[model samples]
Target chain A: MPNKGDFWEVNCYNNSLMYSHHTKQKSLACLALLFFHVLLQAQSPENDFLRSTGKIYSVVAGIVIVFAGLAIYLWRLDRKLTKLEKHINDEHETS
Target chain B: MEGFTDEPGVDLVKPEGIRFPYRSILNETIRNTFFHVALWMAMFSLYLVGLYHAILYLRTSRKDHDLWSEAYNKAGILFGIMGIATGSLWARYTWGSWWTNDIKLNMATIAMFIYFGYVILRSSFTDEEKKARVSAVFSIFAFVALIPLVFVIPRLTDSLHPGNGGNPALGGEDLDHTLRLFFYPSIIALFLIGCWLAQLKFRLLKLSDRVLKNR
Candidate 1:
């Protein structure tokens, strides 16, 4: 992925080309190449398929399920302990 | 100044860019550095607390101390598992595999096994005092062993993991100022949450012990 740095470099290269013969045509050619570079990047299928279709929601859902399981298990264990405490207190009171 | 040297194709006379360094392999998933690395950091901090409680148990021989140690250790192991999972996910995207033969990963598994053995050893003893004493000793041994297994040995050998065998890990070009902003906060948050879980587990265990004694 050509970042801003690459764009800056291309602009610098374009400035250097300004001193050469047929300056206007060459500069226009560089401009065309820059547009093509951006177009190629926009059309790239590498990471876009998952991201654009929002299929990453599946991954997020899986993680959320795991976390929810842990939380629910902890909550149940806490409730069990509370019940056990109450049962023990009732037994002592009856005795 | 540092940003200028980040990209190879960038012209020397051009101004520095605002965006992150776009490496060929680690394009956007480099953000995983914060999540994955922070989990490991939180795990280590929790383990250190567990070790401290183990030492305290050995000194005081208190049942509560043992429970605290066990709770913290369990919480720490949970964080370690999360770290490994996140790391594997990040690896799948960057390294083309969920798991690799990297020395760091091997050593991490070993470290986890050593801690698991500590828990298994604790469960084998029926007597509370005996279990506490034996596990405290084992905890200390495992902590010392893990230092070499996880940190020292991995760095000594050639590995795909960064910061080992000439690879620069985070803080040395891998992590930059922008990444650090998120990374440090993630570490702090994970650590706090781990501690909270440990505290909850310890209280639950303590309450169970009291109920058993009352019965």
Candidate 2:
């Protein structure tokens, strides 16, 4: 025992919910597709591992080079410091 | 205290002036480097330890081995949490996000949870031996899962995470040459500190065991 207006309102509400649900599902699917597309674009040049490995090697090399530079700097500084200390000691001994 | 020190081979006289290492002069602000890198190094090390224990536990079926594995697994998870916090703070300045969906970031989150599941699985078991053994196996699997989640899958997919998908790691570009001067040393020092902490925790466990045996 439902009036025509009541039936119409209920139908409208149900339709809206269904529409929203459908759009949400579609949106999720679109997102997944987009994610895959981005990944493909990123890796499209070559195999993923190859590209990543190259980057890793470059990073490792850079780290090595930087460390080498630091070592040289420290070594030179140590030598200079040693020379200064010896000079000061010689002056002190002479006095 | 003074009389006792002079009495024997033990010379406990304090030095006139304390000289700290050049690195120590960097101070507590430099502590962030330790706090950040140590956690990750510990996390990586413990994961390897857990993996080793898992294999041993499978071969020998020893409960103690399983316990050792579980302890390291727990430690790894704890360190992983610390790592995330430190990394987030570092990122707030560097990447400008409290959190990012970057590959490395997301993979780290996944890695944390995967090991956390090992703890959860351990809790679910009622029997002590069963819990240890089951958790040991789970830890191994979790480590395996971690490889793909962290290294493989993330790289295969697009990610903002450094060191993946042709993006440079946090060495040259992101961390400048000047920063690298401090950063590399910091990594080594922090790693040593992590080993020290883990060793201490392991020793504490052994001490607890001894006390319990005496009781």
TM-score of each: 0.70, 0.50
lDDT of each: 0.71, 0.56
lDDT of 2 by residue, B1-215 (tens): 01111121121222354321112112112224434554576578777887898889889997566666765675676567667765664454334456987777887798888887887898897776777677877887899888877667776676643323643453244333444566667656645544544454455455444444554
For each model, chain A TM-score?
0.41, 0.43
- lDDT measured at residue A3 in model 2 versus the true structure, 0 to 100: 30
Over B1-215, each residue of candidate 1 has an lDDT whose tens digit, in order, gives 12212552322222366554444445454456566777788888888988999999988888888998998888887777777776676665556577999999999999999888987897899898889888888888888888888778877788765434653454386566777888899899878888888888888888778777867
Docking category of candidate 2: incorrect
**DockQ of predictions, in order shown:** 0.05, 0.01
Clashes of 2: 0
The CA lDDT at B141 in model 1 is 89
- Listed per prediction, chain B TM-scores read 0.87, 0.67
